[model samples]
Target: MNSPVALFQELVQAGPPADAAVHFDTACVLGGSIAGLLAARVLSDRARRVVIIEPDDLPVDPGPRTGVPQDRQVHTLLPAGHQWLERWVPGITKDAQDRGASLVGPDQALTAVNGVPLAADGEDHHLLAIGRPLLETLIRQHITSIPNVSVLKARASGLQYRDDEVSAVRYVTTTRADGDEQVLQADFVVDAMGRSSRLSHWLGDAGYDVPRLERLEAPINYASARFDRPETTAELKISGVLELFTPDYPSHGVSVAAANAIEGQQWLVMLMGYGDNRPGRTMEEFRSACAQLPEIFAEVTAGAVRGGVVTYHQAESRRRHFSGLSRFPARLVSMGDAVASFNPVYGQGMSSAALHASCLAAYLGSDADLDQAAHAFFDLQQVVVDAAWAISAGGDTARLDAESGAQVPEDIRQQRWAMNQITAATVLDADIARAFNYVTFMLRHPATLADPDLLARAVTVNEAARVTR
Candidate 1:
């Protein structure tokens, strides 16, 4: 088995070797979300025909869709995700910029954790803060434009199997009677239906052993509101700002606050809270929350409000370990939230989905057995899922502790203490910040933080800072 760090490095590479020949005939991707769209893009290269089944009538122009409730929120495409988008669809960042998305380098983005701002590490880490709607639209357009790819507006009902392998998809079209079902022949099928995906139940209903579902209860409530940007503030150096508060570092009642200069000359601001300390939906309450955050948040919110505050709540973070299953259907795989859905506050949904697409590309590009389970694809995807899960669930687990007033487990206390020290050291040390950012950006694995020398240095730096204070 490949080490997690090595696997992550391989997955992050620009593209699956370009010489991999087409091997699939027909591929069906359910759900037209980022995951499904990216999957279609990857399959388009390997399959003779690829069909994306999305229930919503995707708009020609960039706008919010009913399928994605959190579309209006400030969506930041981390450097890793930006790289994958460009790798799959060349010049996609430029395409988004042309459509009014904002791209910012390290100099133009501000990141502070627990009231301590990280010093610039002199590294070139650029991110695109394209609101989710616009980013999804661009990917949808690019994928649908492919000669071999087409989209169907329908709801997938179930899967059809032959010789223990998925062979077709049964779906109901919006134009037909609600109970009427039609079957589409497919050599391969992908489930990208998101966190609410029913692929597990479908498998169990068909007598296949379903992978264990893991859940970490995270009672998180978040609200996002848009504000008009002032023309005079064009001189402002920063286009994006993020302040994160952990259980170790509580900021009033707020968990996180982020502001981004999005398209339409507006500043999109989001405030998040946990448990009982929920953000209010009213504009006044939203502004009050912003006032509690960094001064940048207040300055941005000083302008006219663009729309009402949009609020969303997530109950838990979930993951299905398909790789752990002993038996599974062939020619069928699940991606995106169907496999794992982490806390949205980490902004890992879309980026993780993009990485999953990379795994699919690598799996299909290889000459593999189609009559058996897709363990190779599941293994590659597990690394991507676990990387995101650790960052997201780790923080939420701490919050759960705070909520219950429970003590940290004795076995994990040392690890937690080490991480806390590292987090504190990020503000004082530039190199540590770069390493930390690399992991958080999903470009590297979390194991990189376990370097003994790095941990020792973090402790020493934090001790010195405390002595100085």
Candidate 2:
């Protein structure tokens, strides 16, 4: 099977035929978030009209809104995600860079899994460091600019079905009361309403069985704040991340010196902890939390002007098993956090969403039946979700094995040990570091790190490090 990256490359090289037939007259996206915008962008090519129904009147500028509470948190576009966005929205990276966003090598901001600074290997694997709000705004601007795409400020109330097929979307304008609902007929309806989606409830109401849900409860919490980049630390262009979420240690700290897309030199620092070790909202507590992780966090935060601190709590990572459902409504699909939401600390949500959008595009471009597209899209989306889940929730599960009273299988245990050696080897070997970076960025599969040759080198490096210690 082709990787998502390869599929995207093929799509880019073989642009849609000029005389391609339209499959649908109209498509409705239930949310105006990143996932919805990307989906609408793709739908514009195959559908005569695409409507993005959102509750909030999106801002014209780069600023936080109430719709996405996590917009203020630290965010970076992984290399794979950056490529997808650039392909979907031409000149998007340049547009963001022109407005103070920076594209920096991943090594500049990364620390090895063992708390050692990663070596600068001079390889060019650039990742985007811009505010999440700015990224969303730019994407929205691009999608809305397409001739067939438009935005409507309204809240999706439910799905209206004709016989057994999804036929229309019921919604109410933001200014209107509940009784004054309106319906928009659509050939297709997509739910990109993030983790708060009501699609499952709406499905149950429509007499369809709700999909089974799989959840991993890590019970993690985060506290994030922006700070003026200290003049003393201006020379350091990279960010600092100290992850200590092993079975022994459950706290993590990250200080990202991202170029604010709107203006000014600022660093977004976020501290995360699992269960009872949650980070505090106060400045002093934040400092104390950082002091517990690594010295770099305290050093960078010292003498820095602070911004408002925001806290968020997440009980679990969730996945709805839509692909496993015996029956699903025709002409309806879900994407982004609505389908699967991972632990944000792993930074896989946005990239996974981008990959899902690519899957949607691939399905839309096919000659398959529209009524059966939901199953095919969900099957493809499950692959993307599985990879992300293994990376984020899998790590959390491994770290909390003892606390959760879960037993790791023997084969899985060996794999984890090999992965640990690879992580340790990254501090000494640039090649290993590159492989680790690629896996972390979702550009490559984790299995790539466990190749026989690589594993041999990692074991050797691990033994040498142990002897020296």
Per-residue CA lDDT of candidate 2, range 180-276, in tens? 8899999999999999899999999878969888999888777877777655676665554434434444334332211221224667777776787
- Name the candidate that leads on TM-score: 1
Backbone clash pairs for candidate 2 read none
Identify the runs in model 1 with alpha carbons over 4 angstroms from their true place. Answer: 14-16, 246-250
Worst 10 residues of 1 by lDDT: 245-254
lDDT of residue 20 for candidate 2:
55
- The number of clashing residue pairs in model 2 is 0
* Model 1, C-alpha of 40: deviation from truth (Å): 0.7
Per-model RMSD to reference: 1.4, 3.1
TM-score of 1: 0.97
Query: Which sections of candidate 2 miss by over 4 Å?
Result: 1-20, 119-122, 230-232, 239-263, 303-306
